[model samples]
Target: MTVKEVKKGNACALLPLIIFVALFIGAGVLTKDFSNMPLNVAVIIASAVALLMNRKEKFEIKVSIFTKGAGHPNIMLMAIIFILAGAFATVAKGMGAVDSTVNLGLSLLPANLLMVGLFAIGCFISISMGTSMGTVVALAPIGIGIASQTDIPVALTMATVIGGAMFGDNLSMISDTTIAAVRTQHTKMKDKFKVNFFIVLPGAILTAIILGVITRGNKAVIGADFHYELIKILPYIAVLAAALAGVHVLIVLIGGTIFAGGVGLADGSYSFGSFLKTIGEGLMSMEDLAIIALLIGGLVEVIRHNGGIDYLLYTVNSKIKSKKGAEFGIAGLVSAAAIATANNTISIVVTGPLAKSIADEYEIDPRKSASLLDTFAGSWQGILPYGGQMLAAAGLAAISPVSIIPYSFYPILMGGCAILAILNGYPKLGTKSKEVKQVATVPVEE
Candidate 1:
């Protein structure tokens, strides 16, 4: 493509996203209430801007591109998951599963360590599920209930779930972000995991410590009337176990829904008609989140097609000089892409080639490059209020996404550690292996 045709660093191409931030975040700041402007309305306005900016393309073509993005396999899958998660959550709650599970947890763990325990649970579930969204879907309701029963703010509790979810997203071997990072940088998954584990371990520990300290004074008061039922809690246990066994997340949620429904039926919690109605109610509850995801998908696709992402890459690529610079560039590149796409795996896949090139030029370790890419992408995903992780958690908890940002301690710490790694060359950068160097120019499969 010709230089003019490439449209690198074209500011106008990013206007839609800029407008979105201005409308969503700026409006919140001005109004002093983040929820004053609904997320869907802001997205819709920005999408219209994107469509208007692409005047050169036929209206039909533009609509087709937006539709393609909205209907992307990943986006569609997330939409389906949202519906299933809503059903599972509603049915499980109707069956008294959430309360029973919460009471069981309260009975087992010390009151003061509740937040820490929740964080740990989120970490385990996300690592097992290999998807932060899945982890959030599974645990957010319980987190909500725990927060309501304790002195903890609901936002802080949800943030804990987000922080832990991102921890696994960055480190899990089966995570899409991990797979993309490893393959793009020509590193083995195990090597990348080893490097990633050490780099982020300190952050995780600090987060846990912070959570404990903050929550130490806020002990939960378990009510004498609260009782646990093992049968009611089986759905959650079964879902966690199935996820750990490498079952597909969709199947896990569907199975959980069915299991919870059966429990409700046997217990006479709801008749068959009522059970079906509850499922419908749950699906309807997820309507807002599903619409927002679709809008974001379409909006992001337009930005990408209009050269916004290319411009971001061009700007970041122009500044790299030394190995450390390249490392930071890779981190920044993926972070920016994640901000634009609202999906870490997609960001990694989009920027992996550029990151590989930067690594090769600087002779940086593939493991390090892979780790940086995954770490930064995951970190950004955790912070973006409109991103799926936070959105899913917020939707499930019936809270605003912006409220959860400040308490996302683990993700913030992870980002800090990533910056430190780039500056200090953590894990000790070594000479790039010949095999890695040879494959540096190869295209990676997404």
Candidate 2:
């Protein structure tokens, strides 16, 4: 059977996405419990709706499209990473790594500076891992434990971690968002980083200061005799060391898992069978996220095929004229994609080509466009209650994702700074006046 092609700028093709938001957000609002409706369930429903919207095509052909999207290289890679992260986190926790790390941190940091310290840790871990979700998986539990021990609110503490996680997500050279942005705009990674760093540095410093001042009175209650086994923390150290040395995330996680199991065995923390059980359970824990990601992937592919994404691109393109407007348009594109997809890296990938076109048309520097894409995508990703970063943090902390939104100071500040950068052309090195036409004309490598 011949399949009917969707026309570009077909707004009706976006109904499935609207249906998804309505069902997901509406359920949460109606139930007054955002976690009551499982995200996978919502995504499944949305996927079905997306499938139904493709009625003009043969059923088997539609299924193929959905399957292809679900099995996209990027989606599969992310699924593997989620599985590895879960196993690593659970194995490390079983081996007492998290508690030991928390104890060591508490012993070193003053009580009043707990929030700032945790934020810094989150930043460091995310920068090393080059993934916000991995950083959240490693740090959220510790942040929760810290909150339980101190007067700091769990939401506030987790928010600090989420904020810091986003900080590194925006700036890390190895981050998927960074790679997508740089490749899409045809800019060197270092050039993008230089522009991104100066734009975000003020926000990071301001966030740290804000966290410190707010938690100044909440001193941690650490006992003088608390014992932390250094060996138990080796897994995390190894992971960080490998990640900082530019190892792939999957390798880092695999090595970390084995190291944690070895440490557990040597310390007699559990039997070999128990170690296997923990790893299995950890992988199982990520089932919901993995499933939801796949469903979202498939659904987005359907939407793209139906011209939803093209509609978005068309809408943004029609409104761009001046340099500031072009910057705002790029930011708007990525931000909208982030909100729609609930994944920053995917958002960058989806919006990158369109953004590059806008930059070329408006004489905006490729590096600045790359920075806008990464920064705005991260900014939106951090605050979205259903976004992976917030979901992971909330899941680990056993709190509502909504609860963390109010305290996501760093993401909020980063977004504000991004807007200011667009408005005032902050970095100043890549403005239209100094535009390198050759950079904008550079071919984007697929």
- C-alpha RMSD by candidate, in order: 7.2, 6.6
Off-target runs (Cα >4 Å) in candidate 1 are 1-9, 111-202, 210-226, 321-411, 417-446
Model 1: weakest 10-residue lDDT segment is 437-446
Q: Write the per-residue lDDT of candidate 2 for residues 1-446, one digit (tens) a residue.
A: 00112134678877877776676567767896455666567778878888887577987887888898777665565566667777877788788876676556656767678888888877765664456887788778778778888878999988998998898888765466776676667666556777888999889999999998988888566455546998887777777566646565567778888989999999899799999999999888767666766676788788878877667656665675578998898888788878766778767765675687677767788878989999999999999887878888887888899999999999999999989998887888833323222222233222
Candidate 2, residue 78: the lDDT equals 54
Per-residue lDDT value at 173 in model 1: 46
Q: What lDDT is reached at residue 186 by model 1?
A: 67
Q: What's the lDDT for all of these models?
A: 0.76, 0.76
Cα lDDT tens digits for candidate 1, 180-233:
676567666557777898899999999999999988887565454547898987
Give per-residue lDDT, candidate 1, residue 238: 84
Q: TM-score per candidate, in order?
A: 0.65, 0.72
Q: List candidate 2 segments past 4 Å from native.
A: 1-7, 111-115, 121-199, 213-224, 322-327, 333-408, 421-446
Q: How much does candidate 1 score in TM-score?
A: 0.65
Position 145, candidate 1: lDDT:
82
